[model samples]
Target: MSRAAEAAIAASYKALKEDFVSNLTGGEIGEINYVTAVAPVALVLWSALQTRQSFFKPYTPLSFAVDFLLNVCAILLATTLYSSTPIVLNILLLAPVAIIYALPRPPLSKKPKVPPPKTKDADAENPLPKKPFLTIYRGAMLVVTCLAILAVDFRIFPRRFAKVENWGTSLMDVGVGSFVFSAGVVAARPILKEQLAGKSTALSTRLYKSIRHSLPLLVLGFIRLYSVKGLDYAEHVTEYGVHWNFFFTLGFLPPFLALFQTAFAYIPSYAGLAILLGSVYQVALEFTTLKAYILTAPRTNLFSQNREGIFSFFGYLAIFLAGQSTGMFVLPRKLSSTATTGTEQRKRLVLTLGAWSGFWIALFMLTTNYKYGLALSVSRRLANLPYVLWISAFNSTQILCFCLVETFFFPGVYKATTAKEEKEAYELATSRVLEAYNRNGLFVFLVANLGTGIVNMTVKTLDVGSRGAMGILGVYGGLITALAVGLDLYGISIKM
Candidate 1:
């Protein structure tokens, strides 16, 4: 009860404080966890190593580097700054990315990539491509959105704004919506092409394939539900569902689009139907007052929450149609063929597409104003008329801008004249790191979902600070990127 006793107690208190500070600042996120990222990172690291000197095409070093840097900055900004940065900075950073992309792409100096050897599923008619940066944009949006949602769900970010009634209210909402929208467009490409080409897109074949693809997604969804419900992970029912089969809906949606394509072959274009049907469906939802029901009621499961999958499918399908139509316009052209005749073809194509994009943007603004903002939300759950229009307009403009850059101003995706040309083209133009991520996006998405669950369980995400949060996201994103790149290097992809 004297000086020695008092000193002992003071020392114990100091040690405890040190430990608490360590846990907060230097827990699981203190260092880059290489184990978590795996072989995919290694594969990308190798590719990145080769391109470390320069990512630009061999001849046009400065412009290519600038464009690539701008693109990376935009994606990085979207990833780290969306929730934190000023609105003006977001506009300033993003506008230039779009402008750089909008500038005409320069002529290809290298040879083109050979189309993958023909398989049963290959489309041999048209070739030549730039990086599938749009899907990269979509998937990156999904990845970023999911990461932010995890921040909230794991209590790394506070739960102050997680609203149930707000339609596409958060980045979380847009994240899930972008994934669905991108999938719809990419998944339906072949069928849409078949329809346009007047080929017989057999329903039986597509139907069977749909069921096969949906099965895995359905299984994965169940696994996710179990992980959340069975494990003591943070609850995020509305992100997708409490027990709703969200993946099942995604799997089922594309096949439905394919079947619809067969039946509605008379419909002139995917874009027309997207704008028309999306608008009408949204009007119906509003007129019937069904929109409100769908938004608020589904608290427990899929339908209990106002026919969640059933109703949202209509809006999403419209997005899918719009995506398909956009793909038709942007993806089908051989940029080399068009760009060979100076910038006239390139400029004209850009103007025409840009005009169309402007038309859609105007349509979006008009609808939003007239509907009094009812149609403005990019809500994943509602996916109403406004949401479809918003995404379509944005995507259309992005495609126009990106194509212009690739076709006229930049020369990253060179056209192949022969097999040798294609091989050389890939070696010269490919950002194996980015290309890898873009190609295996679905797999990367699945990995991110699983990784999120694992991280929450193993680490005290709630204990993480802002620096640690960035570290966690960086590690997770890097892991997914690495894996996707690795799979691509192995000539594998998870298309379904």
Candidate 2:
């Protein structure tokens, strides 16, 4: 083809791509509720199978298949094939099967079991507790994120499930916010621990560490910006901005929070900061010209060009603080907290996390009410108050469900038990595949992004039929899942 012909073809493809993702209004909140329910149910189903000693076993090919089906394929169906149906009803219909598998099995023999070996004061060390539920919840967020990034390219994927153009809620939008919330959950762990231990560090040292921690993400953001521009890749510019990307948003948050390091001394302080930031930002958007500027301002300067990313940082920061607040309560107890017995901690975990979830969801409903409240719409573009609350509420609820499943089906997991029994129960309670993803989440996410690029460059995603799209997605998801599981089985963690 001639140079002009090639240029014309490229232009056509770009137009098609841009048009494909534009002007999308997201689905109802009720539908999202049903869709998000699939992940926890899958967790229950997988653990139930393991507890039953069914054909599924940890780290085996069969287990990998089950994990993929439950985690990957199940999500695909929820978002696409079964989207119109009442998903929660299907879950209820299948509850019996899950219960049967979850029921305790009788021993195969009447022979006495071996007694646990005793050690000398080992339990006194008071190690931090294992949080299988948090791990699985983060893994679920990553998995859903990976799936949406690629699947959105195909025709079979619903436009409503994509990120809304200006103001609305969607699965992909939730994915982005949940990812930030999830990261925030563990971001300040070391800082909080240090405060608890009464250890003081120099301000310069804290600043240095925060920058060092966020440096990789900043570099990745730059890399994405250049690669997309260099390859002339399809991009939804309004999603972030002319040059801004999601990585940039994720990168800036760490250091920003680090500036408020003193607040880490008190957990509830995070809640206060989050509320203040979110509410103040919302007021600015509402009462001032900021919202109009973000929506209609010309992009003649660098700041203007990336106004969405720059302005939305505050909203995301609030969401991050909210996550930190939730994490302090829902995460495993600290060393000082080890005095609480497992059963009591379990009860407290359920109630506290449940209360937080209810609080956020209630706040979201009030703010979104057109009659009685602020009457704001959720906007991922702006990362407004409703958006932050929606993300926190959804993720908190999901995490609560994960905790309940872990506690109910694997009661001994958190109890004082023999090392061998604990190991077995832990394995039974969580998916090894998800554990792999949790172990090296950043690496898996990077791999998925690279794979999506390669597939998009090679395949005509818009032209592909539903069957073809499914096949390509299956292979892509399978490869990514296998890589995570393989690395985990070999005890390899590719951390920065």
TM-scores for all predictions: 0.70, 0.89
CA RMSD of each candidate after superposition: 14.3, 7.0
Task: For residues 1-496, write the lDDT of model 1, one tens digit per residue.
Answer: 3566445545654464355433222112111111111112222322232233333444254533343333333343343434333343434543434444455555445768876564331114334233333533454344444455445544334332243333423334444555665665565457545655788747888788777877777787777668777887765444444565566567667567766676456777777788778878877875654554554442544455436667777877787777776566555433245465324445666776788789878887777663554334345556777667766775566555445434532333344434444445445534544565667776776776788888877888767777787667656655665576568769997874
Off by over 4 Å in 1: 1-164, 192-198, 238-241, 298-302, 334-345, 370-378, 412-430
| Backbone clashes under 3 angstroms, per model | 16, 0
lDDT of each: 0.54, 0.79
How does residue 37 of candidate 2 score in lDDT? 83
Cα lDDT of model 2 by residue, 13-109, tens digit: 4454355435448988888878878888777777766667543542567767877888777877777666677475457535856566667775554
Residue-level error in angstroms, candidate 1, position 373 = 8.6
* Clashes (candidate 2): 0
Deviation of model 2 at 15, angstroms: 25
